[model samples]
Target chain A: MATRDELLACLAQFRDRCNADAQLRPMLADWERTILIRASDLPAEHLLIVRGGQVYLEPAAADGADLTVIAESGLLADLFAGRITPTEPYLNGSLRVLGTEEDIMRLDFISLMIWGE
Target chain B: MRYVVSVSLGSSKRDHEVTAAFLGEDFCIKRQGTDGDLARAEELIRELDGKVDAIGLGGIDVYLYAGGERYALRDGLRLLACAKLTPVVDGSGLKNTLERQAVRYLEEEEKLIGPGTKVLLVSAVDRFGMAEALAAAGCDLVCGDLMFAAGIPYPIRGLEELTRMAKKLLPEMTKMPFHMLYPTGKKQEEKAVTAAKFAQFFDEAAVIAGDFHFIRRYSPPRLDGKIILTNTVTAADVEELRAQGVKWLVTTTPELGGRSFGTNVLEAVMVTLLGKRWDEITAQDYTALLARLQLKPRIERLN
Candidate 1:
């Protein structure tokens, strides 16, 4: 499990990476999605909203998220920190995502863009 | 001279044109990719509807088969409906015949496949004929449809399970946007992440076969001495395979003008040569024509 501070820092770094990537911004230009992240080991929920090709992280949860990612805090931190690729965990069933296939692929693409895939 | 065009939803960087003679008939075959734009593909098809001898719909499949059942993709069907005069085909007709025969030729003539030969097929629903032939040739087959298509890591080991899963998923899966199921446009050009997560599958198999895009996008960087059996590869693709230390590259389609055109383009060629509507052609027609043309798989030893 990751501490609340660790999760926050991880997401902050993720946000910085996305905002700094000029190529990824244009790819997500028209793609706006609300992603809810839950740390299965933590009693906390967070929201990531993308609008106008920018990503904003909220400290609180929101309803009707376009996608939901559920995993242990350590795993979530690792994923956001680019310490590991998502395919292994997602395929092995360690990471669970609730959303349409397009959203899932987009999430993977975003990770691939920020990191190297 | 007959003009045949393939309108694709893939990247335009792979567009190609070649003029060749088949059975004494001159043909100018061309492929144009719309960079994943559906409207552009549809408009291109409409523009070529009455003008060309035949049109091939590439980068998308109008029908997917498994367990002897066929399911039509909504988007693919929409593109097919755009052609009112020229016969439009998605290459499913040839995939069912040509690919199967290609497998048999490789098994019987080349001895590439035999009993207990390990094979990793990226996706089987789109090329079930090849999948079935591989099984019939007694390969230890692993179908990676779920692993590659969906994000699941499960490797299906037999056709029975593949059929069961296809029946459960294809109904809804075929309705989704085609891009979600497979790479298209710029995504097709992107490199696979350098991860060993899926490398075990590649390392375990002596032969990897199926759709070229799937094989290219997900395969591990080094193949050393493995054989790749698939359809459609550009010249650049050939060089890449050679650089990866591949020993053999076998494309189901014959090479034309230094490019292995997709089944869609070749099927369009056959349709024009036969002067028959796409709907009126049968599997026997394709087999007989393939025999007449003596169409053989293009095999090259890269390493």
Candidate 2:
């Protein structure tokens, strides 16, 4: 039962951390696209737009997103918090990803910034 | 701190902790064992009754369901009598509720199974709730109760056909203990999976749904993109699946501490979190709690 505001803050932090990390910046530089993240249970969606080796978070949709991730907010938080594995929800069919294979690989790498494992 | 203990007739091999978080609450199920002695299982329940929040009776069932008819087990009644203060559940209470939610989530939400998607359910008699949900969702289903469970080699058409078959066989099946019906012995250890043998069903079906052990026994070398819908898997099991090129695996049961969990522990957790006795919680309550938790299966890509 994470509040909407807390989940939003976590998303912002992930975006900010991704922008700051040197290892992740190089990976983000390869893709200049918007990514839409929507929660299944809550009416909250965040768009991450990557441009010029930096990632930015926006509240609304943008043109030509790279990936669209649909999952519950709790699951998203748990993934970032390293409480649950990224592949667990995806494998269980709770997390849905509409992206190329390369994008999926890069997304997993970006998650490494938040969690080492 | 809420304490939930699972009293099991299984040996130390089956006894372990299950840690998980659901609906913002972190919970744990302490596995207590009796080394396969049924009397020890009752003794443990009697010992922990008032001290613990709830108790989960493992390796046995309260009832064997056959459509509308339910045959209650004498062992289950004796165990229930042993408990004085806390609610003790054999996990049958949540079968209809949790299992139905598990199937519907895969169809309506996850979109894994559609109108024409062929599904192979290994045994409808064992997982009746899941079978009912699959049929209600309108998937072309192959019920393998007669084939897999009874060694009859007859794949029933729909849930109705399987229900009729179960009505005939489940009474006899219930005469023996549930552990005899679903063994945790050497049969569960070694999986004699040959892709060539089940190629016909694997070729036609989009998903193969069944009990975990049943699926494990018949799993092929490669799954391609076929989704496995079952319960009770371990971390080692996932690695085995990944090595076999299983692109997606969906467990009906929620995973905890790097493995899928038993229904007994799951039902006990629900009873504790709901702050209600097992008898007080209804199927509707389970469905509502399932919605609140938004429990769905996980998938992996190895191919």
Q: Which candidate wins on DockQ?
A: 1
Give the clashing residue pairs of candidate 1, or none. A117-B192, A117-B193
lDDT by residue (tens digit), candidate 2, B170-204 = 54344433444443345555554332445566557
Q: What's model 1's lDDT at B197?
A: 50
Q: List DockQ for all candidates.
A: 0.07, 0.01
Q: Is the docking of candidate 1 incorrect, acceptable, medium or high quality?
A: incorrect
State the weakest 10-residue window (summed lDDT) of model 2 chain A: A108-117
CA lDDT of B196 in candidate 2?
A: 44
Q: Model 2: clashing residue pairs?
A: A90-B299, A91-B298, A91-B299, A91-B300, A92-B297, A92-B298, A92-B299, A93-B297, A93-B298
- Using lDDT as the measure, the top candidate is 1
- Show where candidate 2 strays beyond 4 Å: A1-117, B8-15, B21-26, B32-40, B73-82, B192-204, B220-222
The Cα local distance difference test for each model comes to 0.88, 0.69
Report lDDT (Cα) of residue B158, candidate 2: 87
